[model samples]
Target: MSAKTNKGGAQAPLLGSKIKLHIEKLAIGGAGVARHEGVVVFVPQAAPNEEVLVEVSLVKKNYMEATLLEVLKPSPARREPPCPVASVCGGCNWQHITEIEQRKQKEQLVLETLKKFNPTLQFEYLPLKESPRSFRYRNRIQPKFKNNHFGFFARNSHDIVEITDCLITEEALTTKFSEVKIWAQGKNSKDLQRLEMYISEEGSVRYGLITDEDDGIGFSQVNRFQNEDLVQTALTWAGEDDYPHVLDLYAGAGNFTFPFAHKFKNAEITGVELNPKLVEKAKSKIKEKRMKYFLSDVESYMRRAVIGPEDLVVLDPPRAGASEYIMRALAAARPKRIIYISCHPVSLARDLNWIFAWSQKLGTPMKLARVQAFEMFPQTDHVETIAELRVDS
Candidate 1:
């Protein structure tokens, strides 16, 4: 099924004859899930249980992409998005969806991913942790400059969209946008590649200009309000039992390590990171303590890591997930408990499968103790998840 172009001259390829469909669920990427003529059609900005009139935008062999032309029936969980450019900005995917609904959806996604990866594993979904402040929670934002104005590119597109205020950014940052814009215009603004802003939990604001001259923008948590909460939650999971040794992998600027040091005063905490600049900064921030900072690839550190039964490990890997060599090292260490924090569910699932396989081979199984998802980025398809695994005695 295809539709003829109207006066607008926008050529949209229709994939199905059915114009109206009831969305049954949400795809992993935050698109509305529906079937037209037995083919899956994904419509953006359409929530689950919503009856929408979709315009077929792109058609593929197995699935179709669509634009929500009209919402015949809105879901009860829908809310008015705060950001004017929320729809255009690719940073957020669930802005229109209510916060409660967003949490629920993320929880479901985590559980489903775990089930797919480990079929025999049984664990209860932990209560979703809510960020103390949802809106204006982001401490760091890297807005790009284009055409002599400060703005951010649409998700997956280089085309810039000028932004006056960002809903996810701190109020102080949003208010200072004009100041930053003016500063950029005066300097060799064209030479400026990216603007990175960081607002601490105490409301301290710092900005970094990514350019050819200086490459050091210390590692900082993107979401301000959630950062503290996430740190506290992780510390709780890394209990202060007989285990006095803690390993913090991917420890950027000591965000987790700095706080963990204070939380577990008697424990020996080590942070391993690849960035030398970050390691130096982390060392400066964490003073007069048993904390150790190493500048090396996480996999390399893990390979040389020797852990005893009284140690607990925390792995906060990037979107690519932990490497296979690191996974094997973790298996060898056999920590009493391991905390895995990930931004990509697919990679998390893959690593979990590898861990499960290793445990099965060793005949000492590791069980998923608990799993929870946090909505760090609203109005986008991205999710931040944390999973706890304990080795069965």
Candidate 2:
């Protein structure tokens, strides 16, 4: 095939164009939404109710992407970022926006995405749950060591932005910065080295290099404080009603499965996971004989297994959301209740649309019961949400 991009790599018609616009609201993927000449524009590092001068960086057919050049009118929710390297670091995108505003943006984005998908759908929209510690809540971080510059990569670039401390990380992990630097220097390798630092289960600081063959531990919730609240919210939304069986899909290390097992002592909990490491960890904590975990992808597991009306389903899918096949299968199974926990609102909304559309086509419709957003990651646009759906009588 021909070269991937144009000669200068302009995706659409309007590259290197500058425009002034009023940001109406925050959109998914951590950007402020604006409209220019009937075309949607997305500006990063911007806040709602703000006027900004932006330069068009990437242009698509329907939407355009812009970089915030100057904030002509700053929003009341804007604040000074605590970290000195916040502007460059790729970790936190909404640090310039206030914590309260960060949550507001997340809630609005989640609601907007869901509404855009299904306008007629109705559900209870609860207030966004805020994290206990906005800063210093992150327990795990991947800091790069290269050419005597040790820190995170800059936004959209491989260049490293050196920093002494990351304010978002926990004190336990930040305190080991000195030791980490020493360990990197002792290696004396010129190439880039990826290192992961986190607080272990026993409350000890641990650091290790990431090799090509051995990637560090699988995906785990970084903010433990907010994670607890998320679990509680999921459990509460699940309600006290008893179901004979609970099926946890995309279960990561039994984060939701364990608590669900405890909450429903009479229910048989079955967790489906693809990662062997996470499956192994989740299996080691098996105290009850009623709980079972399978090492398989959710789509693959749903293919052979059958879900009945007496069972409840709990799904905590990754950012990509559940597959269309799985959603269709769940609709066909017609479970009693489904508690969906999502990290990305766009995918969650799309998945809901698929399930509802399939259920409608199959003549067994599902109704949305409850929904709430969780501000699990502070100083950023990422959000966790729990949605409850039940089969219509």
Q: Give the per-residue lDDT digits (tens) of candidate 2, residues 231-334.
A: 88888878888889999999989999999999999999999999999999999999889999999989989999878898999999999999899999999998
Tell me, by TM-score, which candidate is best. Answer: 2
What's model 2's TM-score? Answer: 0.94
Tens digit of lDDT per residue, candidate 1, span 257-295?
Answer: 777777777779999998788898888876756889999
Give the TM-score of each candidate.
0.89, 0.94
- C-alpha RMSD in Å of predicted model 2 compared with the true structure: 4.1
Candidate 2 Cα errors over 4 Å, as ranges: 1-14
Error of 1 at 73 (Å): 2.6
Give each model's whole-structure lDDT: 0.79, 0.89
